[model samples]
Target: MNFYLDVDRTIITKEHREALELNDFLKYLFNTGEVYWLTTHCRYEDTSSVLSYIMPFLTLENYDLIKNIFPTTWNTLKTEAINFSQPFYWFDDYLLEVEKRILLENRCLEKWIKIDLDKNGNNIMRAAKSHNPNLFSSI
Candidate 1:
């Protein structure tokens, strides 16, 4: 499955300002085979340049292994790239009109979890719970 997320508030965060339960869910995800991390963060080379800073919290061994990291504008260009039959989970602070447009074109079974801007953890999980039961056991 493809798991897209926002960098700042989703995965890595200071202990004092972060939610504890996310570790459990993240561990479960990594434990499962075939996981992909997508980010609409900084520009491709820009984000890759900070690999050292991003690796402590993530196991991105090299920048190239980080598939699907692209600009917000790329959302409009990905229509035919992804296999519509495969599952997808997108988490972003602020969803773009283009994101919604792409989601609308996807197969009916796929879900796009619209996460809150503040990283109120578990809302994404809860949203997945209601729609994609396959992820609930992991959550």
Candidate 2:
């Protein structure tokens, strides 16, 4: 499965301003499936902007792991970069209306995992604990 990640509230904590279990999450993602950047900070082939923005929140080991996440290119909607043919999951704090529509049309609206730290700070931890090899199938 393909795992797309966003850096903001999805991975970094809004209150603490630090990444919690970011290293472990990245390690799990890389080991289990294909990981990619699907955030505004990263577009096209260059991931320097996203890496620089997330650098302050990550440890040396976390930074190294993050660099391995593949870059994605999209013109308008982030969904454009998504490979609908394969099973995938998108982790983000927010989703645009157009993007939501795209996912809804494709019958994969449930694939978007909305991460709201304000609502529940332990959401990431819960997700980590619930990891499975056949992620989509199990769900």
Candidate number with greatest TM-score: 2
Candidate 1 deviant stretches above 4 angstroms: 13-19, 42-47, 55-82, 108-110, 117-135
lDDT of 1 by residue, 96-139 (tens): 57656777866532456544424444333443344456665643
Off by over 4 Å in 2: 127-139
- lDDT (10s digit) by residue, model 2, range 70-122: 99998888998999999888888789998999999999998887766666544
Q: Which pairs clash inside model 1?
A: none
TM-score of each: 0.55, 0.85
- Model 2 misses residue 56 by how many Å? 1.3
In candidate 1, residue 63 scores what lDDT?
A: 29
Error of 2 at 12 (Å): 1.3
Candidate 2 accuracy as TM-score:
0.85
Estimate every model's Cα lDDT from 0 to 1: 0.47, 0.79
C-alpha-based local distance difference test score of model 1 = 0.47
